[model samples]
Target: MAKVTLTNMCMIYDKENNKVLVQDRIKSWKGISFPGGHVEDGESLIDSTIREVKEETGLTVSNLESCGVIYWFNNETGEKYFVFQYRTEEFSGELLHKTDEGSNFWVDLEELSNLHFAEGMDERLSMFLEKEYSEGFGSWNQHQPGKLQFQ
Candidate 1:
Protein backbone atom coordinates (compact mmCIF):
# COMPACT_ATOMS: atom_id res chain seq x y z
CA MET A 1 0.00 0.00 0.00
CA ALA A 2 1.52 3.32 -1.09
CA LYS A 3 0.42 6.95 -1.38
CA VAL A 4 0.28 9.80 -3.84
CA THR A 5 1.90 13.21 -3.96
CA LEU A 6 0.73 16.38 -5.69
CA THR A 7 3.00 18.85 -7.44
CA ASN A 8 2.36 22.17 -9.13
CA MET A 9 4.20 23.52 -12.17
CA CYS A 10 4.36 26.73 -14.17
CA MET A 11 5.40 27.48 -17.76
CA ILE A 12 6.61 31.07 -17.64
CA TYR A 13 6.65 33.07 -20.85
CA ASP A 14 9.32 35.52 -21.84
CA LYS A 15 8.29 39.12 -21.34
CA GLU A 16 9.95 40.56 -24.42
CA ASN A 17 10.16 37.62 -26.82
CA ASN A 18 6.85 36.10 -25.67
CA LYS A 19 8.44 32.69 -25.80
CA VAL A 20 8.19 30.22 -22.93
CA LEU A 21 11.28 29.70 -20.76
CA VAL A 22 12.71 26.32 -19.79
CA GLN A 23 15.88 25.38 -17.89
CA ASP A 24 18.07 22.43 -17.08
CA ARG A 25 17.81 20.91 -13.64
CA ILE A 26 21.13 20.92 -11.82
CA LYS A 27 20.84 18.54 -8.84
CA SER A 28 18.90 15.72 -10.54
CA TRP A 29 16.25 14.58 -13.01
CA LYS A 30 16.37 14.16 -16.79
CA GLY A 31 17.21 17.22 -18.87
CA ILE A 32 15.35 20.52 -18.71
CA SER A 33 12.04 21.53 -17.15
CA PHE A 34 9.93 24.56 -16.36
CA PRO A 35 10.33 27.00 -13.42
CA GLY A 36 8.17 25.26 -10.84
CA GLY A 37 8.02 22.40 -8.36
CA HIS A 38 5.99 20.43 -5.79
CA VAL A 39 3.23 22.06 -3.81
CA GLU A 40 3.48 22.24 -0.04
CA ASP A 41 0.92 20.80 2.38
CA GLY A 42 -0.84 24.09 3.03
CA GLU A 43 -0.17 25.74 -0.29
CA SER A 44 -2.54 26.35 -3.20
CA LEU A 45 -1.57 25.48 -6.78
CA ILE A 46 -1.16 29.13 -7.80
CA ASP A 47 0.81 29.95 -4.67
CA SER A 48 2.96 26.89 -5.14
CA THR A 49 4.02 27.87 -8.67
CA ILE A 50 4.74 31.44 -7.71
CA ARG A 51 6.85 30.35 -4.75
CA GLU A 52 8.59 27.47 -6.48
CA VAL A 53 9.49 29.55 -9.52
CA LYS A 54 10.81 32.30 -7.32
CA GLU A 55 12.82 29.88 -5.23
CA GLU A 56 14.18 28.16 -8.33
CA THR A 57 14.62 31.20 -10.59
CA GLY A 58 13.78 34.28 -8.46
CA LEU A 59 11.18 35.45 -10.98
CA THR A 60 7.86 36.63 -9.65
CA VAL A 61 5.09 34.72 -11.45
CA SER A 62 2.18 36.90 -12.47
CA ASN A 63 -1.00 36.14 -14.40
CA LEU A 64 -0.92 32.36 -14.34
CA GLU A 65 -3.54 30.17 -16.04
CA SER A 66 -4.13 26.52 -15.32
CA CYS A 67 -3.37 24.37 -18.33
CA GLY A 68 -3.74 20.76 -17.27
CA VAL A 69 -3.25 17.89 -14.85
CA ILE A 70 -0.67 15.10 -14.97
CA TYR A 71 -0.68 11.81 -13.09
CA TRP A 72 2.12 9.30 -12.60
CA PHE A 73 3.00 6.29 -10.52
CA ASN A 74 6.34 5.15 -9.15
CA ASN A 75 7.55 1.87 -10.59
CA GLU A 76 9.51 0.80 -7.54
CA THR A 77 7.35 2.00 -4.66
CA GLY A 78 3.91 2.10 -6.29
CA GLU A 79 3.55 5.72 -5.21
CA LYS A 80 1.16 7.80 -7.29
CA TYR A 81 1.49 11.51 -7.96
CA PHE A 82 -0.33 14.32 -9.71
CA VAL A 83 0.88 17.56 -11.19
CA PHE A 84 -0.91 20.76 -12.12
CA GLN A 85 0.49 22.58 -15.15
CA TYR A 86 0.15 26.33 -15.53
CA ARG A 87 0.87 29.04 -18.12
CA THR A 88 2.00 32.56 -17.39
CA GLU A 89 2.49 34.99 -20.25
CA GLU A 90 3.43 37.83 -17.95
CA PHE A 91 5.91 38.22 -15.10
CA SER A 92 8.19 40.57 -13.19
CA GLY A 93 11.55 40.44 -11.37
CA GLU A 94 14.93 39.16 -12.48
CA LEU A 95 15.82 35.49 -12.96
CA LEU A 96 18.00 34.10 -10.21
CA HIS A 97 19.61 30.68 -9.93
CA LYS A 98 18.85 29.68 -6.37
CA THR A 99 19.51 25.94 -5.98
CA ASP A 100 20.86 22.84 -7.70
CA GLU A 101 17.93 22.99 -10.18
CA GLY A 102 20.54 24.24 -12.63
CA SER A 103 21.11 27.44 -14.58
CA ASN A 104 17.86 29.07 -15.73
CA PHE A 105 17.40 30.09 -19.36
CA TRP A 106 14.75 30.76 -21.99
CA VAL A 107 14.16 28.67 -25.10
CA ASP A 108 12.29 29.54 -28.28
CA LEU A 109 9.66 27.35 -29.94
CA GLU A 110 12.10 25.91 -32.43
CA GLU A 111 14.57 24.99 -29.69
CA LEU A 112 12.15 23.09 -27.44
CA SER A 113 12.55 19.66 -29.02
CA ASN A 114 16.29 20.20 -29.33
CA LEU A 115 16.85 20.19 -25.58
CA HIS A 116 17.73 17.02 -23.68
CA PHE A 117 14.46 16.19 -22.02
CA ALA A 118 12.88 13.64 -19.74
CA GLU A 119 10.44 11.03 -21.02
CA GLY A 120 7.00 12.34 -22.03
CA MET A 121 8.37 15.89 -22.14
CA ASP A 122 7.38 16.61 -25.71
CA GLU A 123 3.86 15.28 -25.20
CA ARG A 124 2.58 18.09 -23.01
CA LEU A 125 4.83 20.67 -24.62
CA SER A 126 3.44 20.31 -28.12
CA MET A 127 0.00 20.82 -26.70
CA PHE A 128 0.96 23.90 -24.71
CA LEU A 129 2.67 25.60 -27.60
CA GLU A 130 0.13 24.50 -30.15
CA LYS A 131 -1.25 27.14 -32.46
CA GLU A 132 -4.97 27.71 -33.35
CA TYR A 133 -5.42 28.92 -29.81
CA SER A 134 -7.06 25.77 -28.51
CA GLU A 135 -6.69 26.70 -24.88
CA GLY A 136 -7.77 24.43 -21.96
CA PHE A 137 -6.69 21.86 -19.39
CA GLY A 138 -5.64 18.26 -19.96
CA SER A 139 -5.17 15.02 -18.04
CA TRP A 140 -2.33 12.53 -18.47
CA ASN A 141 -2.75 9.49 -16.30
CA GLN A 142 -0.85 6.24 -15.85
CA HIS A 143 -2.89 3.74 -13.89
CA GLN A 144 -1.69 0.30 -12.92
CA PRO A 145 -4.16 -2.36 -13.93
CA GLY A 146 -3.55 -4.88 -11.15
CA LYS A 147 -3.02 -2.36 -8.39
CA LEU A 148 -5.89 -1.75 -6.00
CA GLN A 149 -7.57 1.61 -6.09
CA PHE A 150 -6.21 4.16 -3.64
CA GLN A 151 -9.68 5.37 -2.89
Candidate 2:
Protein backbone atom coordinates (compact mmCIF):
# COMPACT_ATOMS: atom_id res chain seq x y z
CA MET A 1 0.00 0.00 0.00
CA ALA A 2 1.10 3.52 -0.69
CA LYS A 3 1.26 6.29 1.89
CA VAL A 4 -0.88 9.24 0.97
CA THR A 5 -1.15 12.76 2.36
CA LEU A 6 -4.02 15.15 1.71
CA THR A 7 -3.80 18.95 1.71
CA ASN A 8 -5.66 21.95 0.31
CA MET A 9 -5.12 25.48 -1.04
CA CYS A 10 -7.62 28.24 -1.81
CA MET A 11 -7.52 31.34 -3.93
CA ILE A 12 -9.50 34.17 -2.43
CA TYR A 13 -10.38 36.39 -5.32
CA ASP A 14 -11.52 39.97 -5.02
CA LYS A 15 -12.98 40.14 -8.48
CA GLU A 16 -14.07 43.74 -8.39
CA ASN A 17 -10.57 44.82 -7.51
CA ASN A 18 -8.90 42.30 -9.79
CA LYS A 19 -6.71 41.05 -6.96
CA VAL A 20 -6.16 37.78 -5.19
CA LEU A 21 -5.14 37.18 -1.59
CA VAL A 22 -1.66 35.70 -1.12
CA GLN A 23 0.52 34.78 1.80
CA ASP A 24 4.18 35.59 2.04
CA ARG A 25 5.16 32.44 3.83
CA ILE A 26 7.73 32.57 6.63
CA LYS A 27 7.85 28.84 7.20
CA SER A 28 8.58 25.85 5.07
CA TRP A 29 7.84 26.30 1.37
CA LYS A 30 8.60 29.97 1.79
CA GLY A 31 7.70 32.75 -0.65
CA ILE A 32 4.32 33.79 -2.00
CA SER A 33 1.51 31.27 -2.02
CA PHE A 34 -2.17 31.02 -1.20
CA PRO A 35 -3.45 30.09 2.25
CA GLY A 36 -3.71 26.39 2.98
CA GLY A 37 -2.52 23.49 5.08
CA HIS A 38 -2.86 19.80 5.87
CA VAL A 39 -6.29 18.23 6.29
CA GLU A 40 -7.24 17.08 9.76
CA ASP A 41 -8.44 13.58 10.31
CA GLY A 42 -12.21 13.22 9.81
CA GLU A 43 -12.39 16.62 8.11
CA SER A 44 -13.80 17.00 4.64
CA LEU A 45 -11.53 18.48 1.99
CA ILE A 46 -13.69 21.54 1.51
CA ASP A 47 -14.01 22.09 5.21
CA SER A 48 -10.26 21.77 5.61
CA THR A 49 -9.72 24.40 2.95
CA ILE A 50 -12.20 26.75 4.59
CA ARG A 51 -10.69 26.19 8.00
CA GLU A 52 -7.18 26.75 6.76
CA VAL A 53 -8.18 30.00 5.09
CA LYS A 54 -9.78 31.29 8.24
CA GLU A 55 -6.83 30.29 10.36
CA GLU A 56 -4.21 31.68 8.07
CA THR A 57 -6.01 34.75 6.76
CA GLY A 58 -8.74 35.37 9.35
CA LEU A 59 -11.43 35.26 6.68
CA THR A 60 -14.36 32.92 6.32
CA VAL A 61 -14.95 31.86 2.75
CA SER A 62 -17.88 30.19 1.09
CA ASN A 63 -19.31 29.18 -2.28
CA LEU A 64 -15.97 27.71 -3.08
CA GLU A 65 -15.51 26.88 -6.75
CA SER A 66 -13.60 23.71 -7.27
CA CYS A 67 -10.66 24.68 -9.42
CA GLY A 68 -8.97 21.25 -9.51
CA VAL A 69 -6.34 19.03 -7.84
CA ILE A 70 -2.58 18.52 -7.98
CA TYR A 71 -0.87 15.30 -6.98
CA TRP A 72 2.56 13.76 -7.09
CA PHE A 73 3.82 10.23 -6.73
CA ASN A 74 7.08 9.52 -4.98
CA ASN A 75 8.94 6.81 -6.78
CA GLU A 76 11.30 5.97 -3.94
CA THR A 77 8.91 5.82 -1.03
CA GLY A 78 5.73 5.19 -3.01
CA GLU A 79 4.16 8.12 -1.22
CA LYS A 80 1.51 10.22 -2.90
CA TYR A 81 0.66 13.80 -2.01
CA PHE A 82 -2.55 15.47 -3.05
CA VAL A 83 -3.57 19.13 -2.90
CA PHE A 84 -7.18 20.13 -3.49
CA GLN A 85 -7.43 23.51 -5.17
CA TYR A 86 -10.30 25.93 -4.76
CA ARG A 87 -11.21 29.51 -5.66
CA THR A 88 -13.85 31.65 -3.98
CA GLU A 89 -15.14 35.19 -4.23
CA GLU A 90 -17.46 35.00 -1.22
CA PHE A 91 -15.73 35.81 2.05
CA SER A 92 -16.21 37.82 5.23
CA GLY A 93 -14.35 39.10 8.30
CA GLU A 94 -11.30 41.27 8.68
CA LEU A 95 -8.11 40.06 7.09
CA LEU A 96 -5.12 39.43 9.31
CA HIS A 97 -1.89 41.18 8.49
CA LYS A 98 0.30 38.31 9.58
CA THR A 99 0.14 34.84 11.01
CA ASP A 100 2.64 32.31 12.24
CA GLU A 101 2.69 31.15 8.65
CA GLY A 102 3.20 34.50 6.94
CA SER A 103 1.77 37.87 6.00
CA ASN A 104 -1.48 38.07 4.08
CA PHE A 105 -2.20 40.66 1.44
CA TRP A 106 -3.82 41.18 -1.94
CA VAL A 107 -1.87 41.44 -5.14
CA ASP A 108 -2.95 42.11 -8.70
CA LEU A 109 -3.29 38.91 -10.64
CA GLU A 110 -1.08 40.35 -13.34
CA GLU A 111 1.64 41.01 -10.81
CA LEU A 112 1.90 37.39 -9.74
CA SER A 113 4.62 36.74 -12.26
CA ASN A 114 6.69 39.55 -10.82
CA LEU A 115 6.54 38.19 -7.29
CA HIS A 116 8.62 35.32 -6.05
CA PHE A 117 6.48 32.22 -5.74
CA ALA A 118 6.83 29.24 -3.46
CA GLU A 119 8.15 26.04 -4.95
CA GLY A 120 6.05 24.98 -7.91
CA MET A 121 3.46 27.69 -7.16
CA ASP A 122 3.73 29.23 -10.58
CA GLU A 123 2.59 25.89 -12.02
CA ARG A 124 -0.04 25.51 -9.35
CA LEU A 125 -1.38 28.99 -10.11
CA SER A 126 -2.44 27.77 -13.51
CA MET A 127 -5.01 25.52 -11.90
CA PHE A 128 -6.68 28.56 -10.36
CA LEU A 129 -6.23 31.11 -13.12
CA GLU A 130 -6.85 29.06 -16.24
CA LYS A 131 -10.18 27.36 -16.67
CA GLU A 132 -8.90 24.98 -19.27
CA TYR A 133 -7.05 22.71 -16.85
CA SER A 134 -8.56 20.73 -14.01
CA GLU A 135 -5.79 18.47 -12.82
CA GLY A 136 -2.03 18.51 -12.36
CA PHE A 137 -0.04 15.33 -12.04
CA GLY A 138 3.61 14.58 -11.56
CA SER A 139 6.10 11.92 -10.50
CA TRP A 140 9.39 12.24 -8.69
CA ASN A 141 12.01 10.26 -6.84
CA GLN A 142 13.94 11.17 -3.72
CA HIS A 143 16.84 12.35 -5.83
CA GLN A 144 15.03 14.33 -8.51
CA PRO A 145 12.47 17.10 -8.75
CA GLY A 146 9.13 16.38 -10.31
CA LYS A 147 7.66 17.97 -13.38
CA LEU A 148 3.91 18.59 -13.43
CA GLN A 149 1.53 18.42 -16.35
CA PHE A 150 -1.86 20.11 -16.27
CA GLN A 151 -4.87 18.39 -17.76
- The numbered model that scores best in TM-score is 2
Q: What stretches of model 1 exceed 4 Å from their correct place?
A: 74-78, 131-151
Candidate 2: residue 119 Cα off by (Å): 1.2
Encode model 1's per-residue lDDT on 52-98: one tens digit a residue: 88898888888888766666666667677777778888788877754
The local distance difference test score of model 2 is: 0.93
What is the C-alpha lDDT profile of model 2 across 1-151, one tens digit per residue? 9999999999999999999999999998899999999999999999999999999999999999998989999989999999999999999999999999999999998997788999899877777988679999999996899999989
Give the alpha-carbon lDDT of every model.
Answer: 0.70, 0.93
- Clashing residue pairs, candidate 2? none
